[model samples]
Target: MDVDFLLNKGKTIGLEGLEVYMVETELLNLTISSDKVREVSSSKTFSIGVRGYIDKRVAGVTINDENLRVDAAFEKLSSLIKTSVEDPNWAGFPPPRKGFINVICRDNRIIHTDYAETMKTIKDLMEIMKDEAIREGAERAIVAEGMTRLGVQKITTANSEGVHVQDECTVFSTFMVLKTVTGKGESDKSFWIMNRRFDLAELESLGRDTARLSLMFGGGRKIENGEYDLILMPQAAVGIIASTLIPAFSALNILEGRSPLRGKLESKVLAEEVGVSDNPELPLEIGSRRFDDEGMPTSSKVLIKDGVLKQVLHNYYTSSRMKLENVGNGFRRNPSSPTTPYPTNFFVHPGEVKLEDLQREVKKALIVYETIGQWMSNPFNGNVKATATHALLVENGEVKGPAKGVLVTGNIYEWLGNKLNGLGRETFTSEGIVAPGVWVEKVKVATE
Candidate 1:
């Protein structure tokens, strides 16, 4: 579609400002069940979103059909904007900005991946899983379900304010559930990995780790109720931090009175060793992007500096309302949705202590690998109640055995603040969250 023509037409219709967003996507998906390829599918889709401003109010419309008529869509969008109720806080679109950086977000290999290559990857993953299961002493491990998806997306944004930007990105993701049945009992574990680049060796490592965890899950025992030091692995820590802590840093949440950091800016909120940043410039990271959905330039910003509440994530709307700087966190789930603030490549800075050293520092603790019901926890008040799916009991700086059916209960603020002990040197990224192992003291762990 000709974006220039659309914008001209909107202006001629007496609209104050206009913006258009287009996304073209091609995806390939493969699913495996019972250790066999179950289905393979491919899809191609195109969507166009149009936003118009009249007076101070703005509204949007999206068209996904192949037979989209740009002229008719623009007419409908104008009518919707005119009929929509005016927002008292409505502000004009962001003015054109300069000095935009280019980030490498696409992989040509993944963009050109075909059905044959996808099938080969599936077969290789199955073989690797089998080999790793045998090597891990879970030869009977069965892959109950698995999925592999590869996608390429082309995004373009144009506004009447002389802003035009375009970019492309590729994504590869895979997940699997492996179950092992022993003479004593049955145990299962799941693993997931995603990245812009394809690495068969990484997939093999994931399989080996999953198989090892499943094998250890057998003959598990519950721990007694007590106050124990806790070592949260990267996966377990991300599950809680991303769900509970990260959302509180949004300016919108604070404006809505749902965030604990509303009036706590520049205050010490966590341990002095704790630092957090939203870095979109990291190479090969999934969330790295040059511009946000609103055509605003993105940059790395320190959200928390040495435990002090430094900054909150904001988009054009929230920043305008609060009279703050826009950090390029604008995001929209789809063309028809309103833009909101969201983090990109969010992570916690690693400390100097290594994971092994941090573990040795603890006398008695639980090493949590994975958890359940983390998202259901409260984020505003910082209450975390989660069940450890895979955990190891440690005593006298020695791992005893697998501990199951253990509940980890604590307040996120306290655990990350006064109770925080150490952070691991090694960092791991999962679903765009990069973090290291975190150690905390005086956590409540019990069977119930």
Candidate 2:
């Protein structure tokens, strides 16, 4: 952790320029309930973050391992920049730069896994969710809950402009919660998968597709509100465009005016069959990163091409206060957060139609597959409400079954402009963007 002697000990404690971020973690957790495998855990952590600047006033600090000494993180970044407040767009940190794109975000067999090989892959994912909830007949199914997590991280960065850097990654996620019953009653469903590698046949096809979609919500109903044509699924279209159109491509929400793509960059604004990108060299996606959180690097951009409005998202202090060109997406939602303009891997471009040929050109749709208050969406005016805790109603194009709670509501510029309709060419990345399954048209649902 000698980030070059903690940036030369913050210039012998006077603090003019310094930065040193570090994180080290290793974790493993497993849980499942009432139907067994109740718990197993492990963890290791250490954190240290510090930023300093004197006259220009910037400050930051985070410490653990009992104030991981470096003079107690530069005396708490010199008493928080002595009552901070003086950044008229202070530009002092970022310096080192290089191509850094080599991706494949770690997964050496989950760092040589164990715990009896992840408890025999969670008892073969609960015997493949009890043989697919007894071939979907379910007169009482189980796997009532689940969880599995494995993590590893290393990250480090230095500063005072010589800008050092380091990185390491690994993540594997899983979640389930099947539960079913017959006589037309109980049902519960939940499924999850996250990556960076680890696949026991895709975690037993995510416990046999969450016991066949929780027995197709056994006799579900309730659907009657208004304008339809929805479809969504790629986890509800990456959870309503990553919570309402990716924070309007934050360049600090377009320089504080809370973005609506403020001043609309290259114009257009969504739907020439929509396209988007941010790609940190794709590969084993988990928001692959090379250098950010201050040390720069990381590239690949094109925030929307056919729908124009190309590029928006920066980092080093919003590209040094909007002077542009810092595509590294700064990021830092912890380690004493600070740097911000996010998005490292964010694609959306996919189409060759197929999700039953885009739900056979919709004739009354709904599909959505799970959502809940999509973060009470509203990226400043690109409104969108959520709550379709699992849907599926389509009519002419088939599947007239499940529906629950519903609600939806829209407006990301009229659902990506003029009710955009068509997207699925099979893509998936969940909770970190990489989408597919979209189609829009009408929208505005509701129910009882």
**What is each predicted model's overall lDDT from 0 to 1?**
0.83, 0.81
Q: What would the per-residue lDDT of candidate 2 be over residues 38-115, giving only the tens digit for each residue?
A: 788898888978888888888888877766666766787788899888977888788888888787888888889988
lDDT (10s digit) by residue, model 1, range 1-448: 6778878988888899988888888889899999987999998989988898898778888878665876677788888888889987878778767767777778777867789987887787777776677776764878899998888878888888888988888877888988887654678888877767566777777877787777777778888899889999877888888778888988988999989999999999889999999988776577888888888898888999999999999988899998876758888889866778888888899987777775666788998888998888898888998999898888888888788799889988888899988888877786778888888898999896
Judging by TM-score against the true structure, name the best candidate: 1
Superposition-based RMSD of candidate 1 using all C-alpha atoms, in angstroms: 2.3
- TM-score of candidate 1 against the unseen true structure: 0.92
The CA lDDT at 285 in model 1 is 70
Q: Which ten residues in a row have the lowest lDDT in candidate 2?
A: 65-74
